[model samples]
Target: MTIFEATGAAGEQNIWGIVLPFVLMFAVFYFLLIRPQQKKSKQRTAMLNQIKKGDKITTIGGLHGTVVELTDDTVVIRVNDTTKMTFERSAVNTIVSSAPAVAADK
Candidate 1:
């Protein structure tokens, strides 16, 4: 092959070599960071959706309470015997404990 032809082939290889690292970096980031974050977000959303009355929970702000009420976008938590507070459902950090199921005395 001519020198020009060899240079052209090397140029094409260099372009790919430059792009490959960026592509691999994106793949690594997706798997190690973005994908896991998305999975965690989905799990958190499911947890929030599953909240119900009597379930004990903690908020992101460190408040502990029992779930007293629920709406699409909000929750009412009973923090004490006489004090209940409302918060966005997303504010719940985790479910501390699920409510005990009651069986009917048939």
Candidate 2:
């Protein structure tokens, strides 16, 4: 057998040595990081898509307001009777309330 072919044949026997580490590392990251992030992203997308007028929301930047209008890709939120800000629908982080807040723990 030629020298290159002999070496390659030997190397093939240890292929798992090279590939297993990468596979294991990817598994660790998938469970610890990637999977949870994907879940949160899906939930966030669903929440954003379901937004409607009069729902209280907080933006990713922590601006709290009530949704006054919604469009395909943007939102108009009223911070006060005469104050409003327009933002991308994705800028919203969470819904705070749809009704007045009351403490359930107290």
Q: Estimate each model's TM-score.
A: 0.88, 0.76
Sliding window of 10 residues with minimal summed lDDT for model 1: 95-104
lDDT (tens digit, per residue) of candidate 2 on 1-85? 8999999988987897899999999999999999999999999889998888889999999999999899999999999999999
State each model's CA lDDT, in order.
0.97, 0.92
Angstrom error of the Cα, residue 2, model 1: value is 5.1
Q: Which segments of model 1 are wrong by more than 4 Å?
A: 1-4, 102-106
- Model 1 earns a TM-score of 0.88
Clashing pairs in 1: none
Q: State the TM-score for model 2.
A: 0.76
Residue 77 lDDT, candidate 1, scale 0-100: 98
